[model samples]
Target: MPAVIVNIQGPYTERDRKLYAFLVHAVWDELGVKRIHELPVARINKVFEEHHSDTSQGWIWESAKRLAMTSVEWAQVEGEDRLHGIAHLFSYAATHEAARADGVLKFEFPAGLIPVLKEPRRFARLRIHFLIALSGKYAVTLYEILESVANLRNPVLEIELTKLRQWLKVPEDKLDRYVDLKRFVLEPGIRQINMNPEGAGFSAQMEALKSGKAVERIRFVIQKLDTRVALEKQIKPRLEPPVPPPVEPMSAFGILLSTRTYEKAKQAAPDFDIYGLEAEWRDWIKGKPRPNDPDAAFVGFCRKRQRRMEVG
Candidate 1:
């Protein structure tokens, strides 16, 4: 009888964590190994491929028939999601007792194994929830992974590589920043948080980053033909007409008087109607109200100015 070992790697995503746990749980039952043995995933992958030679190293697993197993599929226990973390599981055809009798592998785990391997899915979920808690950011890609594998029938021999690829892809913006921070935050000897942004934690941190301003203010607002385009993804504003400035009676009177003066001057002498007249008058008044007799005053002033020009 022969025995196999599984190795789990760190820096694993939520999907990987869940898959690893399910694999170990399912295989532990199949091989009659009651306990999990903690080991390095790189080593397990290397050794497993060396013997089986059927499954690809660190990649797709053909059907269980290929591995001489009864069934092969992603296994879900009560609550779990796929691609939450990365782990490798090995299924030995022989029982641990049988293997131990053969003097190859032990039946028990490297003491305190349940503490490490009991809940891979929980670990993965915690990682994501924590990241969102601290950074006030989320990788849409990771969320999609949790959604992908929450419900599955089998776990030991069947895992989907396609789903794994999709899960591992870190979204563009978060990917760059996440890789840089993983070195400091996730490294050993660093005091770090477990679940991020519990309750309003992420929102509060995000609000703080805004320096007491709305996120909408930072986003671009573009008015285009047909429809307005907001480059930043946010909820669309409510449909309402923009409020126009208040119209004043004085301003209206000044405009009417100016029009009348222009008309009279054009009839008297046909040429360019005074350019900048409205602007100049408006500026002099400083947005003040025009006199009630503005029209009469304009006529009298124009006549006086005309006589003076003729005399000169």
Candidate 2:
């Protein structure tokens, strides 16, 4: 079965709230390790696989696993007013299994297909290349190659200007800062220029050269190149998925209960705590009198009569 990826949002029901809570607890147990199946997320994983299939052992499976492992990252998109949203990464095998067991699948991903995942070890230096190819950007070819070397933490990998032109099929003069900006998509954290150490303080030089002062064209070009290169390094590493925020208490119930018309309760029980109110509501749920209230006798009688349909 081929894998599929999808996303979901939430103002979840009682059952969903409980299930999401349980899944979160499970995910915390499985951090920083492979074999994502062993995590608490497995329950939701099972739900996903039921809609997908696990029968394949080819590149599709690898892709499916990558999609699944990163599936939990949907939490990054959750908003303050939104209770929850889900993203699904499942295979045909898993989805079929789920349909056989549960009868129907409710959620569908916005993207209909999952990206093919590359073998981690086999992609030691070619990871960025694979991303560029997957994204179908021919212009990104040499840029990705350089980025791959940069990501290896190899500080000495240098491409000659002529070699870079031959490799990228672009003019030497046209080779610009976009190449460096591409690095942020892959590495996201590195900052500094490797090719020109003396060019570190070039931004001010560019500003000073911008007055159309025919004083020095060659110096201006160098300064412009340095400024653009700095901008690229400054922007690349931010391409990774954002860090998920710390989990906070849900405010939906608070907002909903606050807006409900409990005018009498507000006046009669001015300091009525919600938990206390719920406890009271549960106890009085079975047509029982609310304890210690003079009005409890009448409320209980009315409730009992309603149950018997005697008044109607």
Please report how far candidate 2 places residue 195 from its true position, in Å.
Answer: 22
My TM-score estimates for the predictions, one after another, are 0.19, 0.17
Stretches of model 2 off by over 4 angstroms after superposition:
1-138, 151-153, 171-312
For each candidate, how many residue pairs have backbone atoms clashing (under 3 Å)? 24, 26
Residue 206 miss distance in model 1 (angstroms): 13
CA deviation > 4 Å runs, candidate 1: 1-19, 27-33, 36-110, 116-312
Candidate 1, 1-312: lDDT as tens digits: 111112222234433333333234323322223443333334333323433322233331222112223212233323443222222233332233322212222123232233333333322222222222222112322332232222122211222322232233334344344234334322211122212222111111111113344221111111111111221112123212224335342332113333345456434433212222222333334234566665454454445545675777
Deviation from native of the Cα of residue 42 in model 1, angstroms: 19
Each candidate: what lDDT? Answer: 0.29, 0.29
Judged by whole-model lDDT over C-alpha atoms, candidate 1 comes out at 0.29
Q: Give one digit per residue, the lDDT tens place, for model 2 in 1-312.
A: 111112322222222322222222233212223232222223343433332334222322233333344332121222444233334433222233433332322222223221211111112222111121122222233223333333232223343333333433343355354444335321231122223222222211111122354221111111223433443355446424344435532211111111122333334443323223432343232222223442343234334433464434
